[model samples]
Target: MAYVLVLNSGSSSVKFQLVDPAGEATDAPLVSGLVEQVGEPMGAVSVTVGGQEHREELEIPTHSFGLERAFAIMGEHNVGPTDVEVIAVGHRVVHGGKLFSEPQLIVDEIESMIEDLIPLAPLHNPANLDGIRVARAMLPDIPHVAVFDTAFFNHIPPAAALYAINSEVASQYDVRRYGFHGTSHEFVSQQVPKLLDKDPATVNQITLHLGNGASAAAIRHGRPIDTSMGLTPLAGLAMGTRCGDIDPGIIFHLVRQAGMSIDEIDNLLNKQSGVKGIAGVNDFRLLRQRIEEQDQDAWLAYNIYIHQLRRFIGSYMIALGRVDAITFTAGVGENDTEVRQDALYNLDMYGIHFDKEANLVRSKEPRMISTADSPVKVFVVPTNEELAIAQKSAAVAAQARAEGLY
Candidate 1:
């Protein structure tokens, strides 16, 4: 049986999954591992197999070197590089900039396309490109497929997506809204119809992906009509370290009135703002602990984050009328019980009924937490982005083989 390798490379870490397509499996990863602190002196590597996990610390300086060492370790465990006929490599390319509406194999033209969008996604695309280049050099014979996070929102209507001013500037620089988290949104959108046993073309719903980086999408009949993120990841709900939805005038105000440099403002917004800006730390786990201990700043920060999130959710709920259901997925949405319950508590007026018992139960499955008589259903569906990548890669690889193109 052939195996598909999915690689999600970040600036300082990499996540890999080995998947067996033909086996009697349920789309779960066969084996998974992560290498963290790639360029740091005290780096670490960890892998899990057959319900067991392991970790080790070592010195590593780059993604390529860490990947080479990871493969060697895989060999030691008998799941070596040659154990399966690696049909293709699927990568998570963060920003496709309207260039890639579908998955495409790596070639000179595609590489050029990625390079062109570097300025728009400065912090993300470069690390993605580095991974692609290193993978090409290591496995010259394997097909590499690029899946994008912006492709799913390419269908957003012009009126909903267009800005109110500066048509010329927007046209020249592609400054219009281009949503992120397309892969996660698409995965959950498709999963909804399957869970409801209905045709995907006939269902309409809203999905909230609330993780460290959060975004929401409104889907009507399987197409994205609107999304929370706009032009960049910084436009949506507040993130772990990002100050989302700030007034545009603040940038100039800080420079002119406060005598702050552009870099200083940038750092303040991207690193020191959001929950951290209010409470002096970014991690929600610790933030919650502080709030429980009666820390006033922590209480204020927590309530502020929830208020922003509730505002967005109420807006999307109105936009997508006659909503079939609402989905909560990703880290914060799935695991944080208090956050989820608090966000949904006062929405009973909007045809939403909250079940206290159901909402308290936590599991790694698609679960319905709304009351039986509620007009709109609320569910917690775990996001499987890596498995979605593997499925798409397998289909594309099979097509390439049948056409004698690879």
Candidate 2:
């Protein structure tokens, strides 16, 4: 089997997945693992291969150290580096900053571009670059490709994307919407056409990826026409701990009137706000439990979240003009039954007919949740971002090989 390893490195964790070019056959796990708490207490690496689980607890001081251990353990378990030939290494690069529109094989110039994007994605791009540098150091002979998160929305038209302000100011600061979660959005958007056995040009969708960092996208004919998140992941929907869609004046007010430092405000918005600010908790599961017990704050938080989500759905519908399908993906989008029901409950006027039973069918595979009679289809699609990265990496590698770019 042709194998490729895809790595997504974050501030505190590294998620690695090995994909089979032929796809997971005969129940193979598609080899995956996580290296968590890379530089802090509770640091450890866990791997599950072919239905077996192995975990090791050790302090890792850096991305290089953790990755070295990970490769070692993969070999020890017979899913070793040498047992399978690796075609390419796909790195999930968080910010491309208009330089990279598609997955590109990593090179000196590409590394420089990633560094230049650090100021825009301080929390993510640096760690991603760390992984890339370490990968280059360790596997100098192998082909490495950078799969970007901002690449999908690079073609968003001006009307839907451009702010209604001065063009000169927008250009000076590079202030415009560059949506994140492009990998997930692209994966699901393409999946819709493939699932319906129709050409991508014929499909229109509004996809919601409701994970810790949530965002929504409006795709028309397989292109990103509009998306919820803006220049950063902190712009659109209220996420686990992110203060989304906040007033710009609030920052100035806090700094001048409340006497808070910029760093403090940043921390407050990125880390201390969102559901945690109003509800004192971020996990939707925990919040749901409190609501079941009739906790007032929990009810308030749930209400606020549902209201915001409903508003986003309506807004995106207007953007799309006519919606063929709406998809739910990622953590909350996949498993949160209550949220699905709440968001679609009263949208009948929009020609959305939901199958309550189908919506409740919780499974790993993609399945339609809307009723047969519904004009607009709704679905639950489990996202496999690693696979998406791997596919893009393989395609780019093939293209480069054909063109002798490497």
Encode model 2's per-residue lDDT on 286-337: one tens digit a residue: 9889889989988887787778788888998988898889999999999999
Clashing pairs in 2: 75-80
| Model 1: pairs clashing at backbone N, Cα or C within 3 Å | none
Q: Each candidate's TM vs. the true structure? A: 0.95, 0.96
lDDT at residue 281 of model 2 (Cα atoms): 90
Q: Once model 1 is optimally superposed onto the true structure by TM-score, how far is the C-alpha of residue 158 displaced, in angstroms? A: 1.2
> What lDDT would each prediction earn against the true structure?
0.84, 0.85
Cα lDDT of model 2 overall? Answer: 0.85
lDDT of 1 by residue, 126-230 (tens): 989888888878877788888889989987999778888799988888887889899999988888888777899988898989887888899999998999888
Model 1, residue 272: displacement in angstroms?
A: 1.9
Report RMSD (Å) for each prediction in the order shown.
1.9, 1.8
Total backbone collisions for each predicted model: 0, 1
In candidate 1 the C-alpha lDDT for residue 348 amounts to 89
